[model samples]
Target: MEFDLDYLVQQLPALRAGLLLTMQVSAIAILLSVVVGLLGASARVLRLPLLSPLIAAYVEFIRNTPLLVQLFFIFFGLPSFGLTLSLFWSGVLALTLWAGAFQVENVRGGLAAVSPGLGEAARALGLTRWQYLRLVGLPLAVRSGLPAMLNTGVSLVKNSAYVSAIGLQDLAGVAFDRIASDFRAFEMLAVLLVGYLALVLSLSAAVRLLEHRLQAPFRR
Candidate 1:
């Protein structure tokens, strides 16, 4: 079959829109994951009486399950319980929860890496627990975990393709739809491969730049 470059070019507008939606979902989900990670990690590290076990369970459950199953549960299964979310929000929520699980471990590991003597010294200097965490612990933990967190960010961007399963018009969905209509499977797939590669590569570069900036202080 002759490759249809013209047909692929004609679909650029739709592809662009799909890419925008993909980025939007990934950005929001990553932000939410950071929030969840920080809070979950803190609770676990501090061993908060009631919250620690719950966070641990959440992390384990999400880590153990497939992301697609989680998306399906949010987008499809919730309606049966009289809770319905729009497809976009459902995808975002599912990704957030799924990525947040891994983020929890990344953060927990970072926190654990902090020298125990540092905490003891902070206490000796008459710092309150909250003060020590805020002024000392949080920065160190984030610095240590930045690479893992950025990796999760990249994974989220790539996995955003899964949102297509719920009929969200992300890049994969758009590519699939275009192929179905034009019957140009190779052309469409090639375009998708390029699109995702470009996106992930761009994200990786940005993360590397940010990682360098964050590490500058520690390197001194």
Candidate 2:
């Protein structure tokens, strides 16, 4: 049988439309994950009463488990609790939780890098705790934390493909559907692989740009 480039080209619009959903879910999840990460990281950093241990437990459980299994638990296991969410929302929630676990680790690592000297120096100079953290610790910590967070965000976008197993029509899901419809599994999969590669490469470039703008002059 002859290959049909026209047919795949015709499917581009639908595929791209599917990509939009992936973008939406990934964006929301990243936003939520960052917020959650900040809260969790702060808990650990502040050694907040009993809260820190609970947050640590959450991070450990999520990090130790396979993400796909976690997705299955949310999408499949959640139903047993009589709490149902749509496929899109479920995908978003699952990704947010998974990403939050890693984000917590990154934020803590960065925050830890804020030297004790900075805090001591600020105190010696009569800076208030809030002012010292706001001016010195937070600024430096957040700057150091950005690259790892961006990398994790990239992973979340690519891993959103796993949502397809639960019937969400993310980019990979649509590609799978097209392959089934056209009986061109190899051709369609190759395109899917390249499409993902392009999206990730573009995202990585954007991350580098942001890093450049933030860091300005090279430290070397």
In candidate 1, what are the lDDT values of residues 1-220, reduced to their tens digit? 7888888788889999999999899999999999999889888888889999999999989999999999999998999999999989999999999999999999989988999999999999999877877788878999899989989989998899999998999989999987788788998889889988998899899888988998787785
In model 2, which residue pairs have backbone atoms overlapping below 3 Å? Answer: none
Candidate 2 lDDT over residue span 54-143, tens digit each: 989999999899899988899899999998889999999999999999998888888899888888999999997657666776667768
Q: Give the TM-score of candidate 1.
A: 0.96
lDDT comparing candidate 1 with the true structure: 0.91
The local distance difference test score of model 2 is 0.86
Clashing pairs in 1: none
What TM-score would every model get versus the actual structure?
0.96, 0.89
Q: Model 1, which residues run further than 4 Å from truth?
A: none
Off by over 4 Å in 2: 1-3, 124-135, 217-220
Deviation of model 2 at 108, angstroms? 0.7
Q: After superposition, how far is residue 156 of candidate 1 from its true place, in Å?
A: 1.0
